[model samples]
Target: MAETRPVWVIYDDGSTGHMEIPEGDGDPALAKPGRLVTEAEYTARLEEIRAARAARHEAEETARLEAARADYDALIAGGFPEATARRLSGYQGTQAPAA
Candidate 1:
């Protein structure tokens, strides 16, 4: 098996603060009793973090676009053309969004 190492972290302060260093490689005094993780575990954790971040960004963008579409519709209903409504409401789509 590949060499594994400690991932130093103390979560009592309600903040994310972790340092990755192999046991006995870095100063022992600086390390908080952390968990030992394999390289595979570390890489998997990184992928999970990346996926969660992407999902969050996608959800945020979907919400923003939905809001813009609503604004565009409201402007159109209030006597504006499709182009004018989209322009005024910052809607990026050229056609009405699918229901």
Candidate 2:
């Protein structure tokens, strides 16, 4: 009955769905059947959204890793052990501890 609250109903197929019942006005069409989207359609839509998000995440991760690699390379060039450099190269976090 709240203005922004959503009304949900369980279908016979065991699926839960929502109907927005506006507090001030209720449309008669709300009782009518809702639009049914195909499974593949929903899957494709979600996949596209997830792929875009993942692409951005991968780009940021790559930038961070490359920066870390550069720092490790600098350490190796400064006479640090290859093992230490390799360990620093693979570390993933906000800040790397002093070697």
Using lDDT, give the best candidate's number. Answer: 1
| TM-score of decoy 2 | 0.44
Tens-digit lDDT track of model 2 for 1-99: 367544544334434345555676543243444443445644565576678889999999899888887877687778888678767676444544455
Off by more than 4 A, model 1 = 1-33, 97-99
Clashes of each: 0, 0
**Which residue pairs collide, candidate 1?**
none
lDDT of each: 0.66, 0.61
Q: lDDT tens string, model 1, 43-77?
A: 66667678888999999999999899899888988
The CA lDDT at 76 in model 1 is: 82
Best model per TM-score: 1
lDDT, model 1, position 94? 72
Off by over 4 Å in 2: 1-44, 91-99
Quality of model 1 by C-alpha lDDT: 0.66
For every model shown, what is its TM-score relative to the native structure? 0.65, 0.44
In terms of lDDT, the poorest run of 10 residues in model 2 is 27-36
